[model samples]
Target: MSDSEQPGPPEPDDSDPPGAEPSSRRGRRPEPIGDGVGAAHRTWLEPVRSRLVASGLTLDELVGRSGYSKTRLSELLRGKGYYPSWEITYSVVRALDLPPWPLRRLWTAAAREAAKKQGWIENRIQAVQPLGLEQPPVAHQAFTLAMRAPYAAYARAFLQAEDRAQRVVRETFDILWLTWDEACATADVKRHAWQMLRSRVMARTLQQDGHPDLRQAAFFTAAQAAIIDLAERSAHINKMAGFFDAVARLPQDQMDVIVLTHLCTIDAAAVPGIVGLSPAMTHTLDHHARGALNDLYRQHTWE
Candidate 1:
């Protein structure tokens, strides 16, 4: 059979009422809109969908308020088809009276994950100007300053460029600013901020065989602190490669602790604050991580 003759997914019936599920699509699962990005971006969509329900407005009402067709709104709400453009997404956001910047950030992230080009993303976002969302609160500014260096260090260790690291940190801070109230409500906002930074950096980090590929960072050796003779430096770099590979294989919690304390050289006393763990717990994880690395080293030596 020719490609053009192959059956495609059913199209929604325009005759169906604005909010009604198309009969053709009934009981058929919609393919996820942005599964390429992972679940975090999709989690951000849940609340926006809930907002439509919370408003108690029918789809017809949202159509009028958002100036978008009901069918379009339905697809956006269901995450059924193409990842909606920020222009349409923001219009619904405004109509729902929800906060815009956070959704915008998430939407942008999902769009990127969907492989949308930068020019398209930028053009869509420029359609709506978000006022009052531009300014970060005083507390956010203070936190950003205190956390900026360590966050950049952690990001650079994974991402390997000053510009990329700075961009990731800035995006993390912007997200933190949007969610400051929720972060402050937690036991430690610093830890909350760190997780946000970690998520952004790790999203950009390369993967190898289901683990983060940190071996590349080891070869990019100018960022390392140690200074040694030429031959020694080469040997040291090779040693660091094995160390980073081992670190990459560590469990998530252990890897976080190792990256922050051992690689970035943040003080152990301060780690609990950034990781949102109790000091004793941080110590335990660190000890376990060291033990695991030692075991890996011994196994390599034996082999």
Candidate 2:
């Protein structure tokens, strides 16, 4: 199609009577057209209109930005008509970048309507853009922790048969509950305790001669500080049983190695001595432990 061949949009025909419907009454506003229309729409659109205008958008600009016809947009803004489908609402919400209070309210309202007829699918359906709905001054904590749950679950299963399984369970809950005790101070204390424990343990072990990187990563090394900060903010689940059922089923020896090397972040070599694993079996244990931890640690920081 040539550029000129594109059809020009038609102007709104005001002469066409609005044709009042059964919903009309004396002093009553015209019904906003939609499926499952809510009262809020009657109240919100004129405000949306004023906001769009205040933000330097002309009526045509608002219409173009919203991907709605000028007539439809005007109808919405006039409180004479509106259709609050997620598609239309999303367009308006995105163009304006609605404030946090209004933004969350929109999703909450949409989600409630979506809930009765659907489950998780509807949850996603109701979710608006900028999916990180966690309000500012606090990073999006809920979704972040939700993302970690799978990793937590997987590692819990992977490390089954290890005694540190309890620690895994504990770490999961600890990560979840850090915010409950006041985020900053409690996190600082936890970080400090782990840090001192790692530094002291490493200082003594290096005197015995071992790899330093292993020592650093094995303990409260700087590499994992972000992990600590996030764990501090986490609030997933606590006071729940079956935390480290994985480690419980595993041999006590394997569990000790994971505790010493992973959570304690001590030298990896220390694990064999601590867990009492034979030199040959140490290789098998290391392979399994690394696999288990890869997911667990990755979850702590996934974007």
Q: Rate the local accuracy (lDDT) of all candidates.
A: 0.73, 0.41
Q: Residue 242, candidate 2: how far off, in angstroms?
A: 53
List ranges where model 2 is wrong by over 4 Å. Answer: 1-38, 79-82, 107-130, 137-303
Deviation of model 1 at 27, angstroms:
20
Could you estimate the TM-score for every candidate?
A: 0.71, 0.27
Best prediction by TM-score: 1
| Per-residue lDDT of candidate 2, residues 1-303 (tens digit) | 544334334434533235522222223332334554454342345445545655666655656677776555546555443233455555776677654344334444434443322343244345545556445323324423432333233233334323433333333333323222233445343333233223322332322122222222222223444444555423222201122323333343454455455444556664443333565676677667556644544444211
Worst 10 residues of 2 by lDDT: 235-244
Which candidate achieves the best lDDT against the true structure?
Answer: 1
lDDT of 1 by residue, 1-303 (tens): 544335444435434364765333223333345444345456456666655665677776777788877677777777767677787788888997766776787778777777666777776787777546455678888887888888888888888889999978877776676556667988778777777788888888898898888887667655344665777777767787887898988998899888888778798898887777899999999999989998877643311
lDDT of 1: 0.73
RMSD of each: 7.3, 20.7
